[model samples]
Target: MILTVTLNTALDITYRTAALIPHTTHRVTEVVERPGGKGLNVARVLSALGHETVVTGFAGGRTGDVLRELLGAGATARPADGRHGRRGRPRPVDALLPISGSTRRTIAVVDTATGDTTQLNEPGPTVSAAEWTAFLSCYDRLVPGAEAVALCGSLPPGIHVGAYAELIRRARAAGVPVLLDTSGEPLRRGVAARPDLVKPNADELALLTGSRDPLRAAHDTRRRGAHAVIASLGPDGILAATPDGLWRAAPPAPARGNPTGAGDSAVAGILSGLVERLPWPTRLSRAVALSTATVLSPVAGEFDATAYEELLPRIRVTEHPAP
Candidate 1:
């Protein structure tokens, strides 16, 4: 089982335009609304893959109600565990646990001309000190049931930068393996608590480690106290560094479709492996497959089962010994 904490959940909105131009109206060809927040996206995929997933974090207001409603409406929206190699069927998940504050929303304008995207994210709700204290109480209730915990996405207003540090400490005490995915100061401070895993995209890794190269950035990121680091490199796939060693996951085939939430999906793949206690190499492959699946999907932070199945066998992993 995996427990996912999305401090700032959102209702993801995607718009399709022939060409994304600044300050111009364009006809949208498609739109998708789902429970977002990085952890929620991972949870959605994990549930489809049959992992037991519980989600906690901040939510309130009508938007929060809508977010939970949307999530509860989606069948098997389980939290990501990173190991999605199960043979049979994934378990179903459609339960909604209440919390305070309405979730935020993320908008993506995808340009049909270049298949590129322009993303706009809400800063999220204000989490008063009392709200933060309340969230921890919810976490306390949920963390005990999970085999691993994934703390993902951005922080809302009123959330102290050190909040993740506190959550990491609690997870450590609970003996639940943790995977954290966020950026900026939250990512910076969260690592000091030594979570089990941190999955950052190339840009976030660069900002966190000040390295242009993803691999080097991942190497340095490990020094921040995370037990392991997995850097998602888009078409470059996932580069991972842990106490075990260093490994690179490269897809043998070209990736097709839009690239959105592939990182969160990859996080799910990684956690799934942790749940299965599979080797790191296998975890890397699963991450690659799940991420690739996300790109193939028309929606952000979503996965295409057919694409994932096809891509899993094609991902290649090369291992290097740790210094």
Candidate 2:
């Protein structure tokens, strides 16, 4: 099973309006809520793709209860393809450790007229020392059975900055490949742990390496420690630096819709491909396609399956020789 760790799990709430005008009252057209956090989003996408996934992290209080309820119930509606929770395929296993502090909530407001998304995120609840220790115990048990482990998202308040780094080391010791998706100091330290892969967007990449150039920043990041770095360039696509080779992959065209969970979808794509033992180029293609499809999907954490299939072959993947 693929294990995903979301230290700060959340209830993702999305609101849709005809148009978003500053300081003006508007009627809400739609509202959708689901379990969220970087890792939870990845687990959902992985489950949708027919992979056995296990999610573990902090979940407590009322919001945590609702989040876990949704996860347990599975997807509200099954897709036509019947991949997610269909034919007895496993849904994401909930192994979340409860905490005293309440889980956080994230809001995404979509302007349907302009196809823009504005996000409001609350800093997740503070984790206690005891909670952290409990989680580590759970993680230790989960790591041995996991084919891969994803240490994702922000560290909730009260957790040390080096948390991801510690997790990376533990996963590495177990010989399980790990993918880290986080930013700021946690990212700086986690990269130094030499995770199997690191996925950072352009701004995060620039901040981490102090370089705006994608290739230069990616190379610098790898030098700091990651075995491979796949930098997300938003609509421009992805730039990857790995021991096997370097490559750039992009969708045939920019997709228009909510892009809330696009990066997590990309993480899911790469992890799934890695477990399946696909080549770098193929994995990158899947990542880009899934990312773009997530952008086209109306719901957060959901990808347009049809668009993904159509865009896979058309994605442009050009290899670059190591400098």
Candidate 3:
């Protein structure tokens, strides 16, 4: 089973309207709520891919309770009538630990007319030192049984910047491959822990390495201790630098829709491939296809299975000599 850690879990609410105008009151057309956070998003995608995934993180208060209920309701996998070459069903399980601080809420306002999304995020509740220790204990128990673990998203208040680093070290000690996905100092420190893989977007790469060149930035991240670095280049696709080799995976065409959760879907793809023992090129191909499919999805944190299946074989993964 795949284990995912989302330290700052959120109740994601999406508000849809015909259009968004500045300084104008608008009537909402629809509201959709889901359990979210980077890791949860990854777990959702993994479940859709027919993987059994366990999610652990912080959840408390009314919002947290609602989040847990939504997650417990379970995800419905795409019908497997031999359409995607797989017949397995989705099984996503939640194993969140309680905390004193209430979980956060993220709001995304989607303008249907222009297909644009505006997001407003809240800084999550402050975690006490005791809560952190409790989470670590829980994580240790979960790690041993996991085929792979993903340490994802922002570090909530009261949590140390080196939190991901510590988790990475523990996962590594347990011989579980860990994927680190975050930004800023947490990612910087996490890389030093030498995770099995790290996924950063172009901006995060530049912020961490001070280089705009993706290949250079990826190499720098690898040198900093990540076994592999995959930098998302938006519509350009993903650039991966790994011990096996360097490769660029791109979609047949740029997909246009809500871009939220695309990176998490890519993380799901990579972890799915890693657990399945797929080669680097094929893994990247899956990441690219999944990410593109996420962009085509109307809702965040979900993907269009048809788009993913159609784009999977068409994704171009070209190898390049390691720089």
Candidate 4:
């Protein structure tokens, strides 16, 4: 089972407009809302692949209520009784924990003409030390059943920058592998704790390592204490660095659809591969295939089975030359 932790979860609202311009009211051509947060997206993909997944994070407010009512139905708390649920049969655990402040919402305006997205993100609900203490028990209880725990997305206001580092330490103590995914200061701080894996998009990779090339940045990030680093390269695919070697995994060709949540979907593939004890090269190839399938899907966080199956056999995983 894969346990996904989203410290800062939100309801993602996507709008399509003919043209996106600042400070102008434009009629939206379409709109869709989903349980938004990196870990949540990872869990969604895992669930689609028949993996037993449990999701945990800080969710609150009416928006949070909507997410809980929808996404929460799928998560069941780890049993105090101590037994792993069989694969494909997930307990609908309310992995959704409530907080006093409302959860945040992110809006993405997609240009109808070019499919470019302009994102506006809220800072997220401010958390308190007291709330952190409350959730610590939840983390402790869930970590044991977790084969792989993915700590993803940004921290809500008032949550310490080293929050993920603490979680990583706890998971490590319990003999569980952890995957860290976030950005900016939080990511910089979390890397010092030595997560098993960290997946950063190209821009985030460049920012963290100060290298213009993603493959170089991925290798640099691996030196920062992650056992491995996977740099999601959008249409160009993924750049991965493992102890054995570095490789670039790309889909055979562009599938052409919504790119949103592709990186999160890739994270799911990597975690799934980890549980199956697949080779690093297999992990990278599956990640890229899942990411490409996600892009081919109309909905974010969703991958078409047909497309995924088609791409999986064709995803090109090539070794990188030494830097």
Question: lDDT of each prediction vs. the true structure?
Answer: 0.80, 0.92, 0.91, 0.84
Judged by TM-score relative to the true structure, which candidate is superior, 3 or 4?
3
The CA root-mean-square deviation of candidate 4, after full C-alpha superposition on the true structure, stands at 5.7
Candidate 1 achieves a global lDDT of: 0.80
lDDT by residue (1-323, candidate 2, tens digit) is 99999999999888889777889998989788789899999998898789999999999899999999998988443456653334666699999999999999998888988767788998899999999999999999999999999999999999999999999999999999999999999999999999999999999999999999999999999999999999999999999999999999999988877777899999999999999999999999999999999898755668888888989999999999889
Best by lDDT: 2
**Sorted on lDDT, highest at the top, how do the candidates line up?**
2, 3, 4, 1
Q: Model 1 over residues 1-323: C-alpha lDDT tens digits?
A: 78888888888887878987778878999776777788887887787678878777767788788777777666323236534334454432433445455567788888877778888987787777876777788788778778999999888788889888889899999988988898999899988899899998889998998998876788778887988999888898888999898999988775888777788889889998999999999999999998888787655566877778888888999998765
Deviation (Å) of 98 in candidate 2: 0.5
Show model 2 residue runs off by greater than 4 Å.
21-26, 76-87
lDDT of 4 by residue, 240-304 (tens): 88877888888888768888789898999999999999998898888999989889865555676
Better of 3 and 4 by lDDT: 3
Clash counts for the predictions, in order? 21, 0, 0, 4
User: Where's the lowest-lDDT run of ten residues in candidate 2?
Assistant: 77-86
Clash list (residue pairs), candidate 4: 75-92, 75-93, 76-92, 76-93
C-alpha RMSD by candidate, in order: 4.1, 1.9, 2.4, 5.7
The Cα error of candidate 4 at residue 40, in Å, is 0.5
